[model samples]
Every structure is written in C-alpha cells, then in structure tokens.
Target: MHSSLNDHMTLLKEIAEFLNEETEMETMLQGALKKLLTRSVFASGWIFFIDGKGKHKLIAAENLPPALMENDCRSMKRGGCWCVSRYHNGELQKASNIIECQRIEQARRQSEKSSGEITHHATVPLQSGKEKFGLLNVATPNTIEYDQSELALLESIAFQIGSAIKRIHLTRQEQEIALVQERNRLARDLHDSVNQLLFSVTLTSRGAMEMTEDMELRDAFHDIHQLTQEALTEMRALIWQLRPKGLETGLLEGIKGYAEMLGIHVVTHVSGVIQLPSRIEETIFRIVQEGLNNIRKHAGTNQAELFLTVNSTDVLVILKDDGRGFHAGKIPGTLASVGMQSMRERAQAVEGTIEWISAPSEGTEVFVRIPY
Candidate 1:
C-alpha cells in the first residue's frame, strides 16, 4: 500500500509538470482537476475557483454535465453537500463515512433532509503558500470507503497543483524583466547613433560656409550647406520624438513638423490606434526617415504616405513613396554609414523587424514592426 501511494504521488507530480507550461491560467486549473478525478476513481469530484465577488466558479467537475457544472445547487441535507463548510474552514480529510466526519451532526442533518444516498468522502484544499486558492471534492459509496492511504494520495495531488501555479507566476515575471532590459539597450544605441551622424553633418555645413568665395558658386555652396544643416536638425528632432512621449501629441506633432519642413505632399493615417513606447515609436520614426531620405536622393518623388498601427502587443509602421526605386538585395555599406543599415539596426534594437519593398521605377516601401 505504501508503494502504491508513492506511485500515486509520482503521477500527481507528472500532471502538475504538464500544466505548469501552459500560458492560460484557466486551462491549467481545469487540466489539473481532470487528471485528479481520473486518477482517484472517485464517484464524484469538483473544482471551484474563487471570483472577485467571493463566489465559487466551477472550473471542472466529474459526474456533472458540462452545462450543469455551474449554477446547480443540491439540498444541504444530502450527503452531497458537506463540501462548502469544510472548504470554508480550510480542512483536508479522509473519512470511512460521512457519519464519522467531524461535522457529522450537520452532515447527517443535511443528508437526511436531501433524501440522497450517503457516500464516504475524502478532500483537500488547493493553495499556493498561505493563500487558499480553492477546494477539491471527492466522494465514493459507503462500501468503497477511503483509507489513510487514499487520504494521503489526495494531499500529494494538491501539493503538485500548488507547485504548478507558482511556476507559471514565475514565468510571467521573467518575461517582463527581459522586456525591460531590451528597451534599455535600444535607448542607448539610438543616442550613440543619431548624435554621431548629426555632429558630422553639422561640421560639414560649417566648413562649407567658411570656404566659398565666387558669388554664384558661394550661393550654390550655401544652398548645399543649408541642406546639410537641415539634415542635422531632422536627426535631432527624430531622436527627441523616439524617447517615449505620450501617443497623441508626440507622434502627431512630429509628423506635422516633418510635413512642414519637407514641403512635399505628406499624408499620415491614424488608422486604429495611437500611444507607443519610446523604444517602439523611435524605431518607426527612424525607418520612415531612412525611407524618405532614400526616396529624395534616389527616386525624385515629392509625395509620400505614412501609416501607423498600434495593437495589443505590437506596433506597425509603413512608409511608401511614389518615386524611383532600386534593388534592395544588393544593399552595400555598413549600417551605421548608410540609411538602410541604420533603419535595420534601430528596428532590431527594439525587438522589432524591418521589411523593404522596392524596384527600379515602381517606387519604395518600408515596413517596420515593434513588439512590446
């Protein structure tokens, strides 16, 4: 009998191990209850989870139809109803008969009144540490009574269920920690990258202003010098916007600012959302900046479209231009020295990805997605 009880404990642990890896808490609880009932050969069993209103939610049960599992109340007199009070007081028990139960007077009173057969019962409460999560109920006919061994088996199973609950809680905590670390890395990379690029452009502009002499040539040089200065300014603005400003004012204002400076046809779509994390919003902004730069330099188109989608766990940004395009597969140059590489690095830094669509004459499209 000791050997058999040990085997039961092993089975209990196996069931809990299976449930612990599940993402949905509801599914894990139901699976644990199902396995418990099947292993013990109980005449009846039930699992109840507590709700916000302190009501019991019938998560799973045996000897009860699916729809009837919840919202069904039997008379307190029947041997069937000793569970509520036992659960309320946090008791685990193994009894040969309901008459021998500690609360026999109450059990008998309800049993006699319900007109239902008396059944032997064995039960245990499920918990994580000191918190009582719920109760497990099991019953058998009087002839098939519970011995000390059976009671021990029920206790072992309850421990396994509790362990699984704790494991899942730990997993979610780990995922959140990982997310925060990735965000910090991205913020650092953006600061390093944009600052260097803008600084070089600034110095180049200042040098050109001091080196020119011919009136017409100086004017042309001045125009180019101003263009470089503007690029530096754009880089600074893009960096500021990526640093986690609120969704409504930050992105909308940034887009409007870009439109005014570019002096081209720029249309933005609100689509189905707003509000994005600094890391995520920054990646999208960089991808757009790169795509438009490539268009202005290579494609010669004046009109562009920018679209953003912020959903439950992801942010998607798309920038499309009606300008001449080129082969992206043959992209050459270090990411830091080139626009395409910078965009890809920014996307990767924030747990995001980028996709490029372009041809020699059909224009270009840059699609970026960041998962938060």
Candidate 2:
C-alpha cells in the first residue's frame, strides 16, 4: 500500500511539473495525456475539448487499435458520444465509469473483432471551480469498471490539467494585451514625429518649386517634392500596418485603404461576404499589402486587380497586375529581395499556400488559398 501511494505521488509530481513548464495549449494537453497513460494502468487515452457549443475536437490521442485509428480516426472526430452528451447537459460532473464507449461500440458493430479490445472507459470532466472545459478519457484493454481509488486519481490529474489550461489562457491574454499596447504606442510616435516631418517637407518642396524661375532649380525642387510625397505615402502605409485601425469595419476596405496609401489604383472584386477570423484577416491583409507594394515598385504599374472568393471550405485571393514582368528565372533575386519570401512565410503561418505566376511582359499574378 505504501509503495502504491508513493508511485501515485511520483506520477502526480511529474505531471504537475510537465504541465507547469508547457505554455502551449495543445502541447500541454497531448504531453499530459501521454504521461498519464505511460505511468498508469490505462492502455490508451484521449482528450476532447468541447466548447459552449456542441462541437467537439479531438485534441490528443494515444495507442489506438486499428478500428479507431482507421480513416484518420474518423470515428473519434465525429458524433456525440454518451459522455459528451452528458457534458453538454450538465450531467457529467466528476470522475465516473462510462458504461460503454460509443465510438468503440460503433466500430465493433462494423468489424469482426473487438475494437481496441476495449468496451468501457473512465471519464472525468476537466474543470476549474464552476467553469468546465471538456473531458479526459482513459481505458484499458477489456476494462469494464474502475474503483473509487482509481476515479479519485483521475479526478486529481484532471484538476491539474484544468488549472494549467486556465493559466495558459490567462498568460496569452496578458501577452496579447501588452503587444497591442506596444503597437499603438509606436504608431502614435511615428505619426507625431516622422509622419509630420515628411508632410512638412513635401509642402515646403512644392512651394519652392512653384516659387523658382530657373529651370534647373525648379527641377531639383520638383524631385524633392516627389520624393517627399512618396516618403509620406510609405510612412502612412507602415503606420496602417502597425495599428490596422479600420480592420474592425472590414478586411476588404482595410486592404483598399492600404493600397490607396501606397498610391496604387486597386480594383477589387469580392465574391462572398468578407468575414474572417482576425488572424486570417491580418494574414490576407499583409499579403495584399506586399503584392500592391511590389506592383508599385517593380511591376511598373499603378493599377492592380484583387479578386477574393470565399467559400465554405477555403478562401481564394488573386492579385494581378499588367506590368513589366521579369524573366521567371531572374525573379528569385528580384522579388525575393523585396517581400516575396515574407508573403510566403505569412501564408504558411496560417496553414495556407501561396504561388507566383509571371512571365516576361505578360504580368504577374499572386494566388493564395487558405482553409479556415
């Protein structure tokens, strides 16, 4: 009995340390579940994170038999099982024996043999205080029941997981708040100092050009005025990127405003209503910004076309320009020096794909597809 208690204590200590060190939500959950199964009697374990809505996501899973593992764990990813239904209805409150695994039962019905050699499992509601997150499930091959001591151990581990989740969430919120504050501060400083100086220079240069009578002096003033105007436009675009002030209104309008600031005449055709998550919206906006900047600098064209198509599965964005397109082989050194690589990286960050299509004198087209 003493040895068993010591083992449980050791397991709990290890789990607590692991959870405390992990700041990423998915990593923490997956690692905790793996550790729990390796140290305990459970042969397999999985975590389900269900929101206020009935939608469920399989966050982590381990050591699944062929039936459950088939078709990319299709059975686990879909349908509401008994425990999830109970969770939605406020009935599952603590660690208890779930009479039968609904997923396994369904798999068994379709298979000739037992699915995972398992029929029942134990589930504990992962919660902190009055707030509930989801469920943690564990099972052994052919296990049908769990004793009070086992249920109590599961509950303790569940509590640790829940607390860790809350801590990670709160930390992320604080970091995001700090980041926004910093961005806004920088935007204000740039607007007040550099932005104003560029505007003043533009006005002074234009006035000097108008006042001058000598051709050479007038030409010099004209060049200064044009340079200052371009500088102001670039500064405004940078400020907009830093703060993204009008993104709350709509992403298309935000993109248009950024393009206009860069002195590009953009004609946009949007197929569907533009509603996207903030991260997606930001990624798309940055890509579009980069595309327009390229059109302004290298494409040798002041006009561009943007086509956006939103469907149930994915979003498609096409930016096209009828400008002096360069040789395809030479584009690596040309566009890569600009923000082409940065645009690709941004698209990859959102699990999307980006491609460039261009040829000499034919023009350039940027294609981006992202699934939500």
Candidate 3:
C-alpha cells in the first residue's frame, strides 16, 4: 500500500510539472497522454476533443490499435465510438468500464485484414467545473475490471488535463483582447494627430502656391503640396490596416473599404453561408490586404474582383486582377520578399491551401481555401 501511494504521488507531481509548461494545446495533450500511458496500467490510450462545430476531433493518441490507425483513423472520426457518444450526451460522468467498444469489435470482425485487438476498455470524461472538454479512453487486451482506487486515479488525471486546457484557452483569449485594444488606440492617435497635421500642411502649401508670383517659388509649393498629399494617403492606409473599422460589420465590407483607400475598384460576390471562424476571418483579411497592396504597388491596375464561397465545412476565396502581372516562376526564394510566402504560411497555419496563378502582361489570381 505504501508503494502504491508513493507511485501515485510521483505521477501527480509529474503531471503538475508538465501542465505548468507553456505549450500549445496539441503538444500538451500529447505529453499528458504519454505520461499517463507510461505510469498507468493501460495498454494504449487516445483523447477526443470536441471542436466549436460539435465535431469530435482526435487530437492525440498513443499506442493505438493498428486497425484504428489504418487509413488515418477514418472509422473513429466518421463513426465515433460509444465512449465519445456517451460523453457528448452527458451520460459519462466518471470513469467506468466499457464491456466492449463497437469500433474495436468491428475491427476484430475483420481481424484477418487488421493487425491489433482489444476486448475491453475504460473511459473518463475530461471535465473542469461544469464544462466538458472531451473524453480520455484507455484500452486493455483482456476484460479486467478496475478497483475503486484505480478508477479514482484515472478520474483525477482527467480532471487535471481538463483544467489545464481551460487555463490555456483563457490565457489566449486575454492576449487577443489586449492586442486588439492596443491596435485601436494606435489607430485613434494617428487619425487625430498625424493624419490631421498632414491635411493642414497640404492646404497651406496649396494656398502658398497660389499666392506666389515667382514661377520657381510656385513650383516648390506645388511639390510640397503633392508630397503632403501622398504622405497622408499612405498614413491612412496604414491606420486602416492596423484597425479596420468595417471589420465589425463583416470581412467583405472591410476588404471593400481597404480597396477603396488604395484607389482600386473592387467588385465582390458572396455565395452560400458567410459564417467563418474568427481566425479564418482574420487570415482572409490579411490575405486580401496583401493582394490589394501587390496590385497597387506592382500590378499597376485599378480594377480587381473578389469571390467568396462558404459551405458547411470550408470557405473559398478567389482574388483576381487585370493588371501587369509578373512571372509566377520568378518568385523570390527568400523571406525578404514576404508577399507570397506570408500568405501561404497564413493559409497553412489554418490547415488550408493557397495557389497563385500569374503571367507577364496577363493577370494574376490568388485562390485560398480554408477548412474550419
């Protein structure tokens, strides 16, 4: 009994240390799973997290059955086993022995083609307070019942994992709010100070030009007026990019406003449902901004078109322009030219794809598809 108590204490300490590390959600889950599998009696384990769309996402798993891992675990994702359904329905409040998993049974029936087997398992819902994040399932080869102490230990581990996840989520939300606040403050300062000052300078220069009789003096005033106007235009664009006011309405409207600021005529079309996750919305906005900037600086065209199509699972965006396009093959292979590469990285961060099609003297098209 003393040995068992010492073992449990050691495991708890390890878990506490792991949770304190600042890491991403996936890495934290994977680390927790590995620690549990090594310290507990379970032969294998997996974690299923429910996303905002109420879909079960298998975030981390270790020593999983060969059959389940086959074809990238399509069966688990598509069908969803009994444990996941029970947890989602609020029926699984604690660790309990599952006589058999239907998923494993199905695989066993086709055992001639698969590689691994498990007869029974235990599942515990990972919850913090009243919120349920997901479930943790551990499997064993034989149908062995767990004692009270063993079940209690599993429940404790699940609770710790859930609390860690909640804490990380709250931290991220706070950071985002702080960032937005700072951006808005900067935008306000620029509009009230620098932007107004430039406008006044432009007016003063024009008045001076009209009053001057000397041709050279008039020319100097004209140049000052033009320079002030250009600076004001650039400042406005920067402020809009920092904090887009139209974004409160929708992404499309925000992009339209930005394009107008850049002196580009943008025709936009939307089809299907226009809902998107916040991260996806931000990524799309950045991509559009970059696309329009490229058109103004390099494309030398005044007209562009944007198309957005949304469905239950993904959002597609296409931005096209009839401008003096460059050779796509000539894309610089360095981070110094961050136009195309930055867009591609943003798309990839959301598990999405981006394509660029362009040719000299023709036109350019940027296609992006993101799955939520």
Q: Which pairs of residues collide in model 1?
A: 77-110, 77-111, 244-278
* lDDT tens digits by residue: candidate 3, 243-331: 98698899988999999998999999899977887889999998888888788777889899999999988999999999887778787
- Sorted by lDDT (best first), the order is 2, 3, 1
Task: Report clashes for each candidate as comma-separated counts.
Answer: 3, 0, 0
Error of 3 at 298 (Å): 1.9
Q: How well does candidate 1 score on lDDT at residue 191?
A: 61
CA displacement after TM-score superposition, residue 185 of candidate 3 (Å): 3.0
List lDDT for all candidates, in order: 0.62, 0.87, 0.85
Give all TM-scores, in the order shown: 0.39, 0.76, 0.82
The digit string of per-residue lDDT tens for model 1 on 174-279 reads 9866865675566567668866766776677567767866677767767776786777656555553444333346776665455445555678886666766665
**Highest lDDT scorer:** 2
Cα lDDT tens digits, model 2, 44-84, are 88889887765678988988777887778888999879999
Quote model 1's TM-score: 0.39
Whole-model lDDT for model 2 versus the true structure?
0.87
